[model samples]
Target: MSDLYGRHKAVLPDWLALYYADPIEITHGEGRHVWDADGKRYLDFFGGILTTMTAHALPEITKAVSEQAGRIIHSSTLYLNRPMVEMAERIAELSGIPDARVFFTTSGTEANDTALLLATSYRRSNQILAMRNSYHGRSFSTVGITGNKGWSPTSLSPLQTLYVHGGVRTRGPYAELSDDEFIAACVDDLEDLLGHVRPPAALIAEPIQGVGGFTSPPDGLYAAFRRVLQERGILWIADEVQTGWGRTGEHFWGWQAHAENGPPDILTFAKGIGNGMSIGGVVARAEIMNCLDSNSISTFGGTQITMAAGLANLTYLLEHDLQGNARRVGGLLIERLRAVAAQLPGVREVRGRGLMIGIELVKPGTDTADPETAAAVLEAAREEGLLLGKGGGHNTSALRIAPPLSLTVAEAEEGAAILERALRSRVQ
Candidate 1:
């Protein structure tokens, strides 16, 4: 039989590329580092697109997955699974959504799709109000709501579903608008859309826009939007795929970062929930979830193994109190990044909360355009053995620094040091 590396090189398809994969094959990972096939170790600040909450190869999750694999791995949703039930209850309890009903899926996109379906079903409306530059998922219906034109280029066509945009300014959509003006403008836009479009089923937002350069909406944004939606009898769906599972710090839900607003009607979580175990779920009030009468179901939504992994990941998170660590470490990292921004010439802004941070880079003269400087910094960091992700539509110029919750102060400092060096070297 061919060796692992040889088999991968020989058999892997080319069209499967989503993000650019490193030419070097990664063999293993632990904590905040991953090793390539040739045994070169690299610091992982991107956290596998914010999925590795507990870092790679966490022992508890591995053991749970192994134990379940040894016992029963593929129980259909038609049959009751102990781990599945336990995980659902635990997630609902931790989320603080009373009597929350959950439907599990293997990916964030699937969870968002389920949430959209549920919202449409509950409100009996086809229209959806989504924030500009927001990213929900890649599935057909989910992509319909995603505001990033780069991700959903075809969405603008007449064949696509109708979606109204709220606040989309990048460098500052409403920078000129006063706090109250901004709020009024957003509400006015939504009201006009609702008037013309009639009734939108839901208003989907990413409390802090992840792919849109980690742009945090103005304070009280969600509360204000929720009020409007409530008046219109629309459900509120917070797409916490990138911001949930304690990555945002201080709170388990990203919407909490907005303000002390009431809970959303539906919350979709995926990235950090399983700590890289490929599990996603939608938690909604039992009444909202009960809208579907056996007509909506996914064949592999809640598999036995995925639930076991999720349960184990949650157990590890709770036992170790990693949420507190994310808060402390993430604060340190953000402060340090802000300090770096003060010295860096090309940095436009440093924004975001907890581990999900973004550093926007622009040309020295241009106020809004993203230049090659950001890409250069990323490449330099990679050469220094630090991995990062890119965001900001059409620009790909924001440095995405979403490390795992298991990231330590030392790891964060080390990564920040590399970033600082890279930025200084390029911009200076």
Candidate 2:
């Protein structure tokens, strides 16, 4: 381990995971590339788990943050922050929730936590329905609802959580089923589950299970589930931490893929809106948002600096049509990756929408997940100056590829070549 790595281990919790056998210190980043402390530049595919929505060190965002900082950096929610109000207005309109209200938090975890609080308070139920192989957050309430065992550390939770199926469409019992049949089975399962438990406050899910190796059900599965939820008055909370802000290319929001029955009752978003500034929020109809009787405010949630950064970042994203860029580039990248995966025996599947793709590695000629091979490939990719992320259900068996919305065709081609070399280097 490097001296810095040793110092990090000494100070930080062991549970806080670090990537690579030899961890790297990214000293700086620009565009799609980051340079390590030793000055080795790697094309950053993960983008800090998709937190850097636009390009790194974006001048617009930096200027906004700096100007805001110069004016006023931290003002608690008690004050009328213009930047926060303006950003919230834009987000409310873009949220797709009619009569929507937005409440900011510091991170996706806190945003989801607030969503859970609101749902339970509004519905007067602590029961929550979460998808199997799902990841919500690291908080007590979120961990309780998280279906992925690898991340969920404790069973003791404030809410009654039930795990449902259909997140992974490739290896589950329903994997063999057709898309229609899979949706039917999952909906049926959800109905059966509701029958057995008290009415759940909400069914919270990521349209694309980000930490679950970017796994997703058929496009309309959540739409089917939404139909069931509507009848039962169960709120649907789309956890769009990783899938929000047009990262998926085809849709502005991940829930749009399942928008037949209208948008989710509550939507939680973080990671990208601030473009590296800490910005997260929950949006819902005014009715649900106002359900909380007592007053509450996230102290540092919508500070002027972060909100300013968010406003600038969001403006740039919309004006530059990064979503459209994602569609064009992400489409080509996925096709390129699939072509590469086809030649590798260990590659089980190459799937996901737009830039949010995943490559699942498995033992050659067997169904067994090969997390070691996945780890090896990650290291190899790093050696080839390409940085990627690893995630999956329980075992880290899939490589996650989610670059910024500004990823170019040339950069995508370069990343794909490096990834192909990394995959090919693995001994099946």
Candidate 3:
């Protein structure tokens, strides 16, 4: 290990994972690429887990953050901050919840934590329904709701959590069922679970299971669950930390795919909105947001600097029609990857919507998850100057590919070619 790597290990928790066997210290980034401390350029396919939305070091975000820093970087939530108000207004409008109120936090974990607090308080219940193979956050409360064993470090939690099925369409027991049948089975399971337990405050789900390797159930599955939740006065919380802001391409919000019944009762978002600025928040109707009896404030949340970055980032994303770009470019990228997967014996599935995609790896001629091959592919890709991400609830055997929405056709093609070579090497 390099001296820096040794130092990192010494200071950082071992549980805080780093990518690649030999981790590269990223020195700078721009557009869809980053350079390591040793000045090796790499095509960044994962965008720091979808946190860098538009592009790396985009001038708009840099200028916004810099200008705001010159004036005032932080002012507690006690004061009226213009950038905060503006960003919240835009987010509230885009949120689709009636009378929506937005509360900013520093990260998605805190955002979901806030959402859970609101749901439980609003409904006067601490029970929650979470999808199996789902990952909400790292906090004590969120870990309880997380269904992925690898991510959920503890069973003890303040809320009562029941794991539901239907996150992964291919690997679950209901895999053989058709879409309609699958939805029906999951809905039935949800109903059965609900009948036995005290009414849950909300059903929290990722529109696309991010850390669960970008898995998703059939469209309208959540819509079906929404109907049942509505009957029981239980809220629906859409964890859009990785799928929000048109990253999924076809929809502005991941919840929109399951919007037949209506938008989610509560929506939590982080990661991409600030384009690498630390920003996260929860949006809900006024009544639910106002349910808290005591005054609560996020001291470092919605500070002037981050709010400015968020505003600039969001504006650039919309004005450039990056969502449509994600659709057009991401579609071509996935098709290219599907073709590449077809040639590799280890590739089990290449599935995703738009830029948010996952390529599952498995032992050839067998159904067993192949996390070793997955790691090999990651290292191989890095050697070829490409960066990718790995995730899976079962065994961390899926390679995640979520580049910046601003990724160009040429960049996408370049990254795909490198990844194809890596996967081929593993199979050989």
Candidate 4:
């Protein structure tokens, strides 16, 4: 038990396969760096899949959790709690949704499930529409809406969810369709799908597709889709699980990046909202949320400890202006990565804004990049004391870089250096 890896190997459940162990067991983390069991440190560029926005063990969040634990940790959602009310008020004020109401959960998947249920209840429709390459969650309903076929296998009855290609695939970041073309295709697809099935209860989408290879659709895509949904009287649900909480640079919420389009009727978030704490919430307009009165309620949705952590995390994000920092540092990293990509052979494109960036790697003979090369780069980076994540579909290959908002310029430069070395060694 003295050896970290041995201790874990002995006690870890056999049913769970390690996602990415790297032969290094993480013992502690601070800011943007984590120490392995062997006392080796690595710069964390993935940031817990964009979960630790404020950084590891943030002082303010720790204090709030500590204080709340000393008092009360759990309370049935049957009664309103002060921390829950305060967190809801903060969310409503910041979002500028005057009639905003919040429903709390412990994970992004649960929050999305709640949103889907709410959408179905309000619109009273069975069919749901989602974009291609989207990853909502692992739950049956959310997984059904997820566009990735690999994650969800073909079944006899797959929850009756409808799928459509968001836009035409282009030779750029996210498949691009001309604004007009995308709009026309979306409307036609929705019409065709609705003709076969009932009208959709809701149209769910991510402002920027995180698991969908960090794809960002062209400007006016959202606006055009909103118009179509409005014409059909369908609700719009924005899933900001990975892109919200100011991680996308300038905006506090990912949907804000498309404010010119129109705000979503229901917005869901998790990840950075608690700055690493386990908390997710759904923010809905009063009209949509009020429909919940006819449905069954849960007791542990909004516990006191989770609410406290969320409140403190939100306060810290606002007071310190971490959103601005994300924009600034993200710009710096994108520029650096772009420069490196220009010098590399297999590099295809560098996409994303703020801290949510992706490097698409293209192979020579293949139409798309080689996924193995992307894996090599990630492994090389880990060997060099840096960590990164990967994404994209079967023929696609990309390296996802989403570090903590607290990442410094020097650390960013160092990460770029390591990445350059890795790509250089692999390409030749």
What overall lDDT goes with each candidate model? Answer: 0.79, 0.93, 0.94, 0.79
Per-residue CA lDDT of model 3 for 1-428, tens digit only, reads: 39999999989999999998888899999999999998899999999999999999999899989999999999899999999999999999999999999999999999999999999999999999999999999999999999999998788999999999989999888999999999999999999998899899999999999999999999999999999999999999999999999999999999999999999989999999988889999999999999999988999999999999999999999999999999999999999999988888788899999899999999998878999999999999999999999999869999999999999999999999999999998863
Overall local distance difference test of candidate 4: 0.79
lDDT of 4 by residue, 1-428 (tens): 14755677789976443435456667789888998877889999997788888788788888899999999988777776998888888887666455898888888899999899889889987678887778888777888888766555544333567776562244433346665676566667667776787678888888778776787665556666777678888888889899888888878777775576568899898988877778887889998888977645556666888888888878888888888988998899899889888887688778887899988888864556688888888888898999888877544478899998878889989998998898888753
Q: After superposition, how far is residue 169 of candidate 2 from its true place, in Å?
A: 0.9
Per-prediction TM-score, please?
A: 0.92, 0.99, 0.99, 0.91
Candidates in order: C-alpha RMSD to true structure: 3.0, 0.9, 0.8, 2.8
- Winning candidate number (lDDT): 3
Worst 10 residues of 1 by lDDT: 157-166
Compared with the true structure, model 4 gives a TM-score of: 0.91
Report the C-alpha lDDT of model 2 over 1-428, residue by residue, as the tens digit: 38889899899999999998889899999999999998899999999999988999999888888888889999899999999999999999999999999999999999999999999999999999999999989999999999999998899999998888889998788889999999999889989988888888999999999999999999999999989999989999999999999999999999999999999999999999988889999999999999999978789999999999999999999999999999999999999999988888889999999899999999999878999999999999999999999999938999999999999999999999999888988836
How close to the true structure is residue 385 of candidate 4, measured as C-alpha lDDT?
Answer: 92
Over the full model, what C-alpha lDDT does candidate 3 score relative to the true structure?
Answer: 0.94
Evaluate model 2: give its lDDT.
0.93
Model 1 regions more than 4 Å off: 1-22, 156-172, 178-180, 259-261
Which structure is stronger by TM-score: 1 or 3? Answer: 3
